[model samples]
Target: MAGLDFEPALAAALTRHVQGITSVGKLTRLSGGASQETFAFDAHTASGTLPLILRRAPGGSRDGGSGQGTALATEARAITAARACGVKAPEVVYVLTPQDGVGDGYVMERVEGETLARKILRDKEFDAVRPKLAYQCGQAMAQIHQADASQVPELRLVTGPQQLAEYYERYRAYDLPKPVFEMAFAWLKPRIKEPKRTVMVHGDFRHGNIMISPKTGLAAVLDWEIVHRGDPLEDLSWICINAWRFGVTGKVVGGFGDVPEMLAGYRDAGGDAYTVEDVRTWEVMGSLKWGIMCMGMYEVFRTGYDRSVERAAIGRRSSENEIDLVNLLIG
Candidate 1:
């Protein structure tokens, strides 16, 4: 479906859904999406041009396998519910149907901001707003967790121990073992305790998934495919993972600010009272989780399931996570 024509179907859908719309214009595919297809286009209307985005599954199919996260309709519902909770999420304009001729996905308002982590961390244009990003991220995360579970579509309830067992099994399935990973698992198993309460957590609340503006800081949180109901601390710790720092390891919170500042923002936004130690424990789990995911990438590449150079490149970074784990645990 790479070269499939979407202009005709888009024109029909936009004209019908969007009031005073004429046709679609200048559809361009955006990069950096590994699982889904994303396209940006203009919906020319009688009033003015509307910037919109189309996120669809490849070949117009609805399913993306078991580990691929939720379906498109569920993702759209999550976005809508997050927006209602005051989180900076994209407006879900329309969800695509089979009769629409477009793929099984949704159309959303195109948010103008930077989603690249390296550029956001290193670029001079983002200098002024960089320091505030971590705290803002915490605030945004608080809003996401505050969303009513009933308002959003039903999501899987994944506890810390359940996630640990699941990922550990995934790691062992590849028949590859590392002392660092085994040790990390052992360290995490005993510490795994049931959460006193659960909330909607943004499963992947790291750098690239967040949109940052040069002016107002956090613009919107993108990529709701992996959102789930779980401990809110998972969102806090996932951002502190070393891999998300993008080489600025000194700044513990997404290469921008310290943990205290992030917590301050979290508290200001009415989040649960959590301490640094709580986040650190989850950080260790997050590091090991990422390491196993990297190994999975390599396994797919080696088994000829995915032959892309990008997968091979990411697979090589599994060792870096091990080094991070050693420093975090052994030190």
Candidate 2:
């Protein structure tokens, strides 16, 4: 019932496009993912009942402007580019423009697999799949980074060092008291330099954003809203963040593969120039970035854009995890 009433308009729109649409069945919103709204629905066309997913921007806008349309289009474009690069991503079926009357959303194949972060790491049934995850993650990221940024011109919106600076600026804009992050920024500012190579970086690469099957190593990588051109190491470091190790901090690298193994896989695939020092810098940056981002999430909830207790708790924990990273780096 989460999104049932909100979807009749979409069903009507789809009926106009696809012939012989008989009925649009129940539409239920899936939990998790704070930035966007996701729904699973059954489409009963003349042919058969088709399972589909609908993704729309949060509250249909950002920054007091109706630009979710553009973001949705960008997501579609990014998914296409990722698929072309041999990265496992859901196939985009339709992109709804503002004029299309869907309020900026897209329909894609509903990928079947486990996407829960902790389950992917701790589920014994996934033990075989888990060990290969880091390697697959490295390989998939290498492929994603290898993608020509020009293929998706929207990625030109942000570059490497600017991206880092932008993240910091975003935190400052939040106007939260973040002394730990302030220190992290001070430590990271001087080291912010252009990458040796600019490649397609998955801005939010981590175990939680990935999907894996117990029978298969990796099913697909979800969430393309943050795709951009930047240092490939950003993706590597984001994956290895201690927060994502699923209670296996000592294992690192998503608590499955070692750092050397991941780097070796990446390097073997022509992803040279990424060194331990480079990854360390990004790792530190990732911790800082996630911590600030968590604060932003709290702001969203406070502003009534969302009211989930989970968001509130996550925001509160951001500083603790960030402080842990600070201790790791400086202690």
Candidate 3:
């Protein structure tokens, strides 16, 4: 609040567009992400004080995060697509452009739910729904995968082969040697088939991105920056990736349940038919994909892009993905 460069601009934008908002109060800079900055505040409106969250790309451009640094409007439009398919997505209230003087970003209605991955996995308060969380995730994913993405023109439709090749190229540029990643890539290249069942995928639909309720289980899916048209099985397998298991390796699906329960939920929710082999392939691919990203992040740290302890530590996580890739591909 004391020295933030965007505070005055933010106030101006809110005053101009945010209707009936007497003022914004208790504004807090939540997270300083490289691609976008997130903030939470209360809008003192005429009716009532509404809680809201803002996602803004610092300095008017994206940097230091997932995807090719997609624009905030793309994410907002993707969320709208997901919600149209009955997925519980947060409603976007306003999108801020450069003309608004707040940079590029969007404001969303603050939802009431818990997003902590570990707490959802182990906390006793979630005991009733923890066992059912995996299936719930499957049902939610089915809705997302079935969502008509063609409605959102801003989204880029991509195929598996395209992204996989890009990942390999990115990894090579790092000049870091990873045998497991190499072998996994070698195994995946030929197996990559034309996606038989394509849908709009929630690219990063892991535990942390999901919002859960103690009474109802899955509440909403957050983070749409990387969403694109791809194999729906990729979404299914990405959730099952061991890296997102949060230390409880026994329960493969985000430390909550197994494949059968999730598949059953998917079927109940009308997701397209897919094979176990296809899912296994994507699961392995997800591990490799994450490993490549982890190593890439390490390079970012090594190069002093952000130079935080967290960024430096993320590279070490590549080993976890490597181990997972070995178990999936070789075993």
Candidate 3, which ten residues in sequence have the lowest lDDT sum? 60-69
Error of 1 at 237 (Å): 0.8
In angstroms, how far off is 288's CA in candidate 3?
A: 0.4
- Model 2, position 168, has a per-residue lDDT of 84
- What TM-score would candidate 2 get against the native? 0.85
Residues 53-163 of candidate 3: C-alpha lDDT, one tens digit per residue: 888887545333346656788788888878887899888878777677667788898888898888898889999998888788888899998887777665666777887
Q: Tell me the tens digit of each residue's lDDT in model 2 across 29-83.
A: 8753545778888888766888888887664443121322236677678778878
lDDT at position 241, candidate 1:
93
* Alpha carbon lDDT of each predicted model: 0.87, 0.75, 0.82
Model 1: pairs clashing at backbone N, Cα or C within 3 Å: none
**Which 10-residue window in model 1 sums to the lowest lDDT?**
59-68
Q: Choose the strongest candidate by TM-score.
A: 1
Give the per-residue Cα lDDT of candidate 1 at 12.
91
Q: TM-score for every candidate vs. truth?
A: 0.95, 0.85, 0.92
For candidate 2, give the lDDT of residue 108.
84
- Taking the tens digit of each residue's C-alpha lDDT, what string does model 1 give over 151-253? 6646888989989999899989978879999999999998867776799888999888899999999999998888889988899999999999999999999
Once superposed on the true structure, which residue ranges of model 2 sit more than 4 Å away at CA? 1-9, 12-24, 31-35, 44-49, 58-70, 171-179, 298-312
